[model samples]
Target: MHIRVYNTTNAFTSLGATFDERVLLGRGPTSSTIHGELRHRVGSLLPQQGNDASYAQLYIYDPASALEVRNCRNQQLRRDVLQTIQDTLLQVNPFVEKFR
Candidate 1:
């Protein structure tokens, strides 16, 4: 999994230097949250935004590692990972809307 945060408001870009190639946003025994290494990464930006910014966008790149059948028999692991991500996002930004 990898993510990128784009701040249309420019407030998030004001943060200091760039982020490392891989910052652990969150992790579980069978899942890991990865993000792109950029001047302003999602991990750093989210804390600064504080769930207030209405224009921030997150681009998630799932490598499908957890979805591999051999790695995740019955697909339960994949579902767990997806649920983890959803729960994490909602927890971080309660204002986020869910459309399924």
Candidate 2:
């Protein structure tokens, strides 16, 4: 699988990595801000406009640290991509609190 990690600090130039399986190896410290697709099936999980966008992402909250912001195109898979993102990345499983 191919993974691309981008940092808002320098989004123009991104770091790319490849893996043989579906796993998160956790890229560099800059990867604290993560964004990208899962490779093979990524194209299938996207809106017509965002089809070219990535599915996976990594980043951090602190600009001084690794990863900063992550943006995922709405794939509209079995689950709500927004909710999936909130749950997967933000650890907001129920989303009962964040909605408030």
* Cα lDDT tens digits for candidate 1, 15-84: 4344343444446454333344426444432324444222223212122432232123333234555456
Q: Poorest 10 consecutive residues of model 1 by lDDT?
A: 3-12
Q: Indicate the TM-score of model 2.
A: 0.18
Clashes of 1: 0
Model 1 misplacement above 4 A: 1-77, 94-100
lDDT of 2: 0.30
Clashes of each: 0, 18
**lDDT per residue as tens, model 2, 35-87:** 45433332332235643323221222221121212333212222233334344
Candidate 2: regions farther than 4 A off: 1-72, 79-82, 92-100
Per-model TM against the reference: 0.21, 0.18
lDDT of each: 0.34, 0.30
